[model samples]
Structures are given as structure tokens and as C-alpha cells.
Target chain A: MTRATLLTITAPTGTPAEGDAGFALADFDAPQVRITDLSVTRGDGVFETIAVIDGHPQALEPHLARLAHSAQLLDLPEPAAAVWREAVAAGVRDYRERNGEAGSGELFAKLIYTRGVEGSGRPSGWIFVDEGEDFSAQRRGIRVVTLDRGLRHDVAESAPWLLAGAKTLSYAVNRAAQREAVRRGADDVIFLSSDGYALEGPTSNVILLADGVVRTPQTDQGILAGTTQAAVFAFFEERGLATEYREITADELRDADALWLVSSVRMAAPVTDLDGREYPVDAELTAELNRYLLSRTE
Target chain B: MTRATLLTITAPTGTPAEGDAGFALADFDAPQVRITDLSVTRGDGVFETIAVIDGHPQALEPHLARLAHSAQLLDLPEPAAAVWREAVAAGVRDYRERNGEAGSGELFAKLIYTRGVEGSGRPSGWIFVDEGEDFSAQRRGIRVVTLDRGLRHDVAESAPWLLAGAKTLSYAVNRAAQREAVRRGADDVIFLSSDGYALEGPTSNVILLADGVVRTPQTDQGILAGTTQAAVFAFFEERGLATEYREITADELRDADALWLVSSVRMAAPVTDLDGREYPVDAELTAELNRYLLSRTE
Candidate 1:
């Protein structure tokens, strides 16, 4: 398998003037980030990961929009969307050409935009595409636990500095929650707002099915607006399953008819169990959703 | 007059047993970190910054202990204290050697320990020292503002995954809060817990003097145990003032007779104003305290 490909945006915050390439290919294995980059020093940055199926990057625009939204939340400069989009396309093309166009391996493109080296006003951006991990087992089913996120649901409005809705590089707590889930013998986690409402997972959005209606926790409660979740809802809508984005309490989540954690890289990971409570998986429907997700070209 | 000095720990998590050289000098201006380093991607790491004055690194042991403490909070493997300590010494030695030994610059050494490149399973460590910013004005006095931290004071106890107390690299919120302070036309910020208790500053600890007692927000409330704060307390105790660690509320902080934000690099910055309300600066006492802090050889 070919290793990952890397591209560094020469101008991350705006369009490149004439004569500026905007981006260039770089060595992926060698070090490319300065120790002083805010992304390394303070976790001061935004990022997006998009899944590529059959050489098509899924939900590219939504991912880019979210990346911009996250940057706005952090008060960072507006990202040069065209430059980043072109970089992703180039990264994918380079990877496919290297791996052979016939190889239809699932890949992921991670976009990183960081506050550059300390004391430098310039921001930094990078994009890299690599073969995705086998989430086959998780796609079919996975176990999860609920953990307290320790912030009130209204904090998003009450305290923007808390950076709740931003998909920032500062994900240590999310990583820790996932580790806590592993400690409890689970594969993932569903975080709860301190006010007793289900928030989102460390890296995924929570989707619940109840009374034939599908619902996911509202993003206004400081949770991310999942790119894959929108598609998941579309999938359900096509199947005549009503979908929603509303606040789902922890208790309501526990009582749901079914549940899944959705994200770009993993698509739809059905939660087979949550907090020791078992939930049956809809194998056929889940497979169809996966097929539908992989079939998307946008 | 010189740029920063850097030392990369060859082995970050253990004793450099059997002549491993433990650490080596690295080019400071070069890119020494990979984009995949968790410190860059996930902010999955811990760090410490210790002040050095006239060749002596202040509170060396306390800084090391706190680094280890922060690491444990993140479930990261125990850091190699001996190796780290030696690296700090080498860094200081290198700086003093290059610059004149008689040059008494206020330098700060930053220790960064991160979960290494993805899937490498190895940790990374580095130490860099540079002349501190000209905080002479801030040391004299500075304006401040209050922002909500969004997490209740008890979350550190109720929710370990929130990672309140750890000195992790996940500082996006802190950076955002600092920017918010700037937007509010203030020099810095003091974050209050959602439940209306004074927490700490984004980068410094809050020390309040009230009713003849010197107080600070308790560390149990998910605040870092400030190495410089301990010295501040000692400064107070020596002058026949009672020092305390208690849950100071927002109103109590406002009512305090005097206040200062203390940290390693900045030393002590007396808050001249809070939310536009003026507070008298004790210039004489502040200078003496800073003098005592700088003169320390331990």
C-alpha cells in the first residue's frame, strides 16, 4: 500500500496572489511542523477529516464549511477554501496515481489549519490522504458508554470562549473519554451535558432511533454539526424514516429504539451496547446505509 | 540577542540507560515535529515552563513534579524525570555558554512532552529556552477581565475526563479566552467557574489579597498548582500575612484589597484594573517580591 501524501498550503488564510503556488507537495515521513507552531504548543487550531471512497472525497464542501466555522469560533483567520479544496483534490490524485487507479481502497484526507510558529502572524495549513483503517467490525456494531461532559447545555451561548462547538485540535478530553470507555470494556463513548442531555461522542455524533423516528443531539448544545450525520439523515429520509436534530436526554438515549455513532471516517457505527445496556443491531439497514454512504460522490 | 535553544529527548519516558546520551541538541529554527504528533493533532500531551534568571533555573523540582503530575492526569506514561532534568541543565548550560556567563537575561525554559507520531507508541520530549518577553510593563500592572470557564468547580472531581487540572497542550479555549480579553480591551482574563466561583487565568494563577489574608483559588478546583504562586505565598508569609488556598467567589475576588496573576515567565503581574474598575498597584511590594523571585538559586 502507498503511504500518505502531504501538501502544505503556502497561504492558508487567503487566496494566493499570482506567482504564489498556494500549496506544494511535501515529505510526509519527515518532520514538517515547528515545535513552536500553536497547533503543537497550545492545540490552537481547527481540522477536518473526510473519507474518500472510489477516489471521491465525500461531503467535501460540508467539511470545508465546518472547517471554516471552527476557525471562526477560534477567532482564526478565514481559511482559503479554494486553496484547501484544490490541495485535497491533488492529494487524492497523487495517492490514486501512486497506488494505481484500479485500486479502490478507502482513504481519508485530514485537513489541518494551525496558528503558525509562535510570534509569527501567519497561519499554517496542511492536507494529507492515507488509506483508512478497517472499521468493518465497528461499522457492523460497537459498544459504548456515557460520560459526563461537565458543561451545561447552554454554555455554547453563555460561554463561547469555552470553545464547545469548535472542532479544535484540543481534543485531549475527548481522547481521555474514549480511553475511559476502553477501561470500562467499551469501544466508544457518548458524552452527556451536565444538564442531563446527551451531547455527542468524543469524535462522532450520536444518532438515535425511537418510535420509527431518527434523532440526533442538537449541535446548539456545544456539539459538532456532523458532516456524516447530515448524510445519515438523508439515508433515513430516503428509507421513509423520519429524522431530527434535537436535544436528546441521556435517559431518552437509553430508551431509544436504536442508536449509532456517525462520523466521516467511520460512517455509521451502530452502538450494540451502551453503559452495559444491550441494543439490537439492524444489520440489513446498516449495510444499506454503508453502501449508500460509500456510493456518494459529493 | 540570541534565538531559542532546543534539546530533544532521545528517550522521553525512561532513564537513558547504558549510555543512551539521554538527549541531544536540535536545530531550533528547523521543523522538529511531525503533523501527526498528538501534541499537534489532538493536543494530547503535557507541558511546563520554568523561568531561569542569571543561569539558575527556579523551582526546578516543583516544575518537574508538576510535569509528571500533569502527565499522570492524561493517562500518559510516566515521564523520564532524570532525563528531562538533565536536558534542562544542558539547555541552560548551552545558553549560558553561548551568551556571556555574566549576561543576566530573564530566560524561560519550556518543557514539552507529547504522545509521539501516530501509531508509533513512543512519547516525545523537548526543552527550549529563550529570553522572556518584555513583561516589565505587565509586571508593574495590567488591566483584566472576567470570563466564564463553563465548567463547574466540582467537575475536576465529578468528571476526570474534563481534564481541568492537567497542564495539557489542549489550550484552545485558553487562547480563545485571551483573545476575548483583547476584544474587551483588556490585557488579560480571570476565568470564573460556571457556578460563579473565581477559577484562574488562562495562563496564570489568580492571587487575591483580602481582609489581610492572601488567597488563591484552590487547586482542587481543577487549577494548576502554580510553581510561582507558591513563591508568592511564601513572599506573603514572610511579610507576616496569612496565605490561603480556598474557593474564592467572583464577588470575593472583586472585593479583594489587591490581586495579582502569577506564572513562571511573567513572574507577578499586579492587576491594575478589572472590568474597568481601577485597583491601586503596590509597586514597592511587587518589585520586592519579583526581586526575591529572581534571586532564588533553587
Candidate 2:
């Protein structure tokens, strides 16, 4: 099935009106940024991806807060959240109208702001809405490899310039880790700090269920706080389950009753294997959590 | 002076012939990459910048080698260096022709290859030639701030997936460090490893002259090997000066007889002051090295 896409360009002076269906997904093209644009050239930018369900973006407030935080971390001008909200709204509305109701399974909304061309002093910003990937098969159960992230848990606190918590566009290393996992016959990777602490997955946050308690790595461990994880923890609290954020070691992950990689789109995925060792899949728990997540989003 | 830019797009099926000057610098624009493109959405790409003097790119061989190395580290298919060379040649030629002889200043030639939209398996490749910045004022002497890179010296060896040696487009952290340096009233930054090793600069490689020997951090310290530093060392070797590739501690950097940051475009910039500590300018040595670098390129 062809995924519908919507593009919205937001400039400082002239903001493109919303719901402009004049441009088709195939016809959408980005204006050529100067070759010197730091975003394109050096990956000097910050971005956020939100999941859209039934034409509404989920967890937008948290995402926007994180995006703003990322901008400040990178020393970029604070992005106008209101402008971004309008763009996301327009993009989703346009996508639904063009693709029709039958195409409304799920959509991925992306917001990007780049430090524009050198000396222009203008930041380039855009919003994109596209068809989301179907993760049903993998969400049932998946395999992950443990890879070293090559940094101590304290590095982020000691070095704010490392941009540990900010979701900047310099994701080459993260992508590389994912690629390596695929090559090794795993579905994803769980990155461990140099000192052997389980930090996070390449694109998701690591969650461990043990003794009826839900735990994830502390955000202070230099990992991007997962929005979905936050939502899930809130769900857990509402359901009267214990939730904790603390440093988790690689050994602790192996010893947990169940493991899941959580993200915005994938929601909660049970891990069937890690480093070729089989793990028990808590099918009942996975299903219950997925249902709760969907209901909350609705 | 307005910088001249030339853009060339190469696709899987079609290779745009060389010297196609039909496009103008002002009229050039990059077609919008699909929102699904990993390069744009995930910054999954590799790039190289070569110094162009009188329309000829300097240190082409080393830069190409490093690009290929970077591609390998990212698990990207090996790039066709010949194609990149052709694109560079065509871009330089077209840029010089359109900009006129009066625009004979230095140019920065860049090559980029991004893993294109997901599932297509096609890589997007391009070459850009644009006006270079004049470093005359800053080249005389500059101040630098020391920042922690937040990774130990041996992390790259333990974590290959971190892409430590690869010159990937994920440079947001590097740019942030430089921005912080500027905020601290410095011209650049020399990154120190978490373990207190003087690693490298945000963009350039750090070189220290002490006790009649020139020393730079070993590439194995998770740093990108600097082509310009290699060339300078070759020049030094030819001139009978001793050179060493070994770990230089942060304290050693402050104690060195002289320190310089070397890169493709900026060439060699002497560090006049580091962290508010002043050092004598080795004007004669800096001038002699620049002449050798330029003369060799010519």
C-alpha cells in the first residue's frame, strides 16, 4: 500500500497556510538548502517523531517539550511549539483527506529544525506526515543483541556538551548499531554503557519487568527519555503496578522476568531472545499493555 | 563576495554527465528526499570535504580513502570513488566557469552519500562545490577551549558500532562543542577524552609541538585521522623534524611549546591562547608550513 505524505514548510516571515492539499506526496520536494546548511551538511539539527492515530498526534506535549529541550541543548533558537502544532495538525488533516479513511491505520509525524545555511542566521523548519510501518509481527516477539555504547553512565552529567539527552539528528551511530543487530540476526540492539550498564536500544527505551515491578534505565544514564515509556509508566501506576527508574546492568536485563523495547510507534515489544539466549515472552502482559496504550491514545 | 555553488545529482540508473553547467548557483536546489529516507530522518550518511585551490581539490586520495573507510564503518556499501572523483571534477569545473575568473578564491568541495528512502535500497549521492571562508584573520592566532568528549580513549576499539572513526554526518555534538567554545570566548575546541586524554578538535585534528617533536593523538584514540595532519607530518619528516603519533594528555597540551589545529580548509591555525592561557606564536613555523602545504597542492 502506498503511504500518504504531507509536507508543510514554516519560515520566519511567511508561514504556509494549513490544509494545502495542492501538493501530492510524490510531488513534494524540499527547497535546496545552501550546501553550507549545517543541518544537511553536518547533521546540526534537532527533530521529534510523533505517532498519529485517527488523525490525532499522541503525546505531543511531551514530544514538544523534549524538542524544545533538544534545541536548547544544541544552542538552537527555541522553536515555536505553536507553529509546530499547527503544522502537525495540517499535515495529519491533509494526509487523512488525501489517503481516505481506509488508509488511517497509523501515521508518523516528524518535525525538523535545522541550523540553516552559514551566515543566513535563519533556521529551516518543516513538518512531515507519512505512513507508519506495521510492527505487528515484530511486536509479538523479537530478538536483540547487547552492544556496548562505549561511554560511562556518568558521562552525560559530566559533559553536557556530549548532547546525551537531546535527540539531535546525528544518529549515524544509532543507525549503525541497528544495522549491526540486523546483520547479527537480531531485530534490534540494547546498548550497554562502557561500565556494563544497560542504557537503551538504538531507537527505543529498555524496560525490564521483574518481581511485578516495571523498571527502566534512569534518564540520568544519558539516554533520551522515551515518551512511550513515560506513558506506559503512567498506565502502570494507574493499574497499581510498581514502576522504577534506575541504572540497570546488562546482567540484570538477562535476569529479568520479561524484557520489552518501548518506543513511540512500536509501543511495547516483548523480547524473545537476547544474544541468542531464549527468554520467556510474557504474552499476557504484552497484550494487556498494548491494549491499555491504544485505549489511552484513543 | 557571494559563494558559487554547483550541485550534481547521481542516481542508480542515470549518471549526469560531467561539466553540465546548465544549472546556476542561485537556481540550484536539492530535490526533497522522501520523509522515509534514513539519511534525512536518521542522518544515516557519510561525507567528506576537500580543499579546492584554483579549481583543484587537495588531498583527494586520502579523503576518498577516509570516505570509503567511513562507509565501511557504517556498513554502507562501498562508495565508487571514481564516480565521486568525476563528480568533484565536474562540480569544480562548472563552478569556476560560472563564477568567472574574478571568483578564483578557495572552494570547499563536498561529497555526500545517504542511504535513500527505506525499501528502495538506492543510495542518494551528490557533490557540492561552494565558496570557502577566508581564514586569514583567524589563521594568525586563535583561542580554544577544552571540552570533554565524554568517551574514553579505548571506546572505539570496544564498540565498533559507535562509528568513532567514521566521518559520518552525525556531527551535531561536534557543532555543539564548537558553539560552546565560542560562547566561552574561544575560537575552537580541543576535545578531551573522559579519561583525560587530549583527543582532537571539533572539526580539525590537534597537533602539538613540544621538545622539538610534533605529536598528535593516535587515530586509535577514537578520532578521525586528519588528512591535513598527515600531509603536515609528511612535510615535517621531509624537513628532518621528529614527529610522533601517541596519546597527548590535556596537561601536555597546555605545556607544549606550541599547539595548532589542522584541517582540510583551515589548513593549520596556531593556538594563540587556550583556556585563557597565552602562548608564544610560532609565526615563522606557521608561515613555513602553510607555504609548503600550498606549494605541494599546486
Top-lDDT structure, candidate number: 1
DockQ of each two-chain model: 0.91, 0.58
Cα lDDT for residue A17, model 2? Answer: 59
Best by TM-score: 1
All candidates' TM-scores? 0.98, 0.93
Candidate 2, residues A212-267: lDDT per residue as tens digits? Answer: 99999999888998999998898778889899999888899889888999988888
What is the C-alpha lDDT profile of model 1 across B200-256, one tens digit per residue? 999999999999999999999999999999999999999999999999999999998
Off by over 4 Å in 2: A12-26, A29-35, B1-3, B11-35
Q: What are the chain A TM-scores of the candidates, in order?
A: 0.98, 0.91
| Models, CA RMSD each | 1.3, 3.1
> What is the CA-based DockQ of model 2?
0.58
